[model samples]
Target: MPATFIRRIASPKKAVTGLAVAAATAGMALTAAPAHAATTSSAADAKAIAKQMIPDSAQYNAFSKIVQHESGWDVDATNPSSGAYGLVQALPGSKMASAGSDWKTNAKTQIEWGLNYMNDRYGSPAGAWDFWQANGWY
Candidate 1:
């Protein structure tokens, strides 16, 4: 007699079950469900959304300039030092909640809040941009 070997293959369901058992034995919980793909917006998308929201060319350009400097049009942009967040870099981020609860992820919400802030504080986006240009913030 020389030697003999046999191999067995488990089905997908059994293999998954075995993996779950092994993970549980290692003190890990397999409570997470299968992940689904989520849609994400890009900086360009944010700009487009802003264009649609702000129809005035000068106002839109001014708003765009501020956002470009503040967040580079990133919806989830954050200032690590100031803790400012979102497209407009709302300090504390929670300030944008008055615009909408989805302020963190929705470009429209951030833009709406930013626009309102500019209108209320500086009279217009162009005015805000002027102030920002001189003071480096608005």
Candidate 2:
């Protein structure tokens, strides 16, 4: 052979290291980005939307109080023993699925499910709260 030239490529270890560095940099950027707030509405908003379902002001207040006591207005709240989850803490947790897919993370769905539950089971928020007070459930 008149002339021969050989060039060694970077090893697998070096390629892996390069990939790791790139991945880490991407992860850091993602973490540094501001978190997006969960799409949600307040209990007041929920009440306003469903006001026709709960016409009585006193009943609305009681229901609002009970939910506040249970979750402090957190739609993601969960009770371990009862598997009650979301604003209204539907037993089995999956009951809110009827409203929408975001039941676990969306406040509007939780509120809608809660309002429906109260109307169907207890006739009103106050009625549901009354049962909750007496039995620690509704």
Candidates in order: C-alpha RMSD to true structure? 6.4, 11.3
What is the per-residue lDDT of model 2 for residues 1-103, given as tens digits with 9 covering 90 to 100?
1123223338987765655566676573223465544765566555554455456788768777777887767676788777788777788779788988777
Per-model clash counts, in order, read: 0, 0
Q: Candidate 1: what lDDT?
A: 0.87
Among these predictions, the greatest lDDT belongs to: 1
Q: Which segments of model 2 are wrong by more than 4 Å?
A: 1-38, 41-56
Candidate 1: residue 94 Cα off by (Å): 0.7
The TM-score obtained by model 2 is: 0.60
lDDT of 2 at 45: 55
CA lDDT of each prediction against the hidden true structure: 0.87, 0.71
lDDT, candidate 1, 41-125, per-residue tens: 8988888889999999999999999999999998889998999998889998999999987788889989999999999999999
Please list all clashing residue pairs in model 1, or write none if there are none: none
